[model samples]
Target: MPFQNTMGDYQTRQTLETFGFLPALTQEEIFDQIAYVIAQGWTPSIEHIHPSQAMNHYWPMWKLPFFGSVDLQQVVNELEACHRAYPDHHVRFTGYDNYTQSQGSAFVVFEGRR
Candidate 1:
């Protein structure tokens, strides 16, 4: 069957792929979290999602297909939830650092940092 174009599925897959949720993750809530990820700033590194390969980590590879939006807090929540569900998936971040002085692609991530 052809894929059903639904936001719920997108949110679920994105959350699972990026955050590593197993089964208990609800489809509806993750969508909300996705919105929060972009709204809060900070981009999910390519490695954050796909850790096996770095050579094709840029774009047009493992991304592009699964590129969906999720604001910062939601990303943090999703990651934390996944960490709780699976210990090995526990990832410790360097925390949110404001590098607003940088440019290109990252300009948004560093925005508001003085």
Candidate 2:
């Protein structure tokens, strides 16, 4: 109900906050969103989204290894495009590091007020 209260106030924007979960996003749906980033010819990884800030934080998202098959910068560019598309929306590419190559469910983030 809390999110409903805040989210209801800005219905469409709230929808943007979601990880493309409307219309009942199945695995394919999640993959579809991920594919949006991947289609740019980069391996999309969960390098940035955070759990607390994500609607799909607790979703059944998982990560797998890419094993010498990845293009980080391309993913970065793709995500950058996504960011450009959603300027006002709160999104973060939250948690990727040297050890992990970001292979998890795509989750949007609500960033701090700039």
Candidate 3:
């Protein structure tokens, strides 16, 4: 079956991917994307990576993965907390599927302060 597109009116995967590197995302934008992911029943996670070590390092999992949040605000709250802590590093929002046990989709919502 073909993939069902969600995040209506939001940027398409192709568009989002255009940012091979993280694009500048406002706090509102991040929250908007978070809201969309939560509505889809996907788990949200934050990843951090340094620009200098982009070649030698991997996207380190910063915090514990969020699974099945009952409240959308909770997920946004967690993301905000993570961003404040790592304000100068690269951070991206990734949503995972609980059933297939695979990454459902991912997007670099923000690329911390350059």
**Predicted model with the maximum TM-score:** 3
Candidate 3 segments exceeding 4 Å error: 1-29, 55-57
Q: Each model's number of backbone clashes? A: 7, 6, 0
**Alpha carbon lDDT of residue 83, candidate 2?**
50
Q: What value does the lDDT take at residue 38 in candidate 1?
A: 50
How accurate locally is residue 108 in candidate 1, as Cα lDDT from 0 to 100?
A: 11
lDDT of 3 by residue, 28-110 (tens): 77677777777888888877665454334358876788877757677667656767787776666788888788767666654
Error of 3 at 58 (Å): 3.4
Q: Per-residue alpha-carbon lDDT of model 1 for 39-93, expressed as tens digits? A: 4553443112222231232322112211233445544464555445434321222
Candidate 1 wrongly placed segments (more than 4 Å)? 1-23, 44-61, 64-114
Give the residue spans of candidate 2 off by over 4 A: 1-43, 46-69, 94-114
| Superposition-based RMSD of candidate 2 using all C-alpha atoms, in angstroms | 12.6
| Cα-based TM-score, every candidate | 0.25, 0.29, 0.64
What lDDT does candidate 1 reach at residue 109? 11
Where does the lowest 10-residue lDDT sum fall in candidate 2? Answer: 58-67
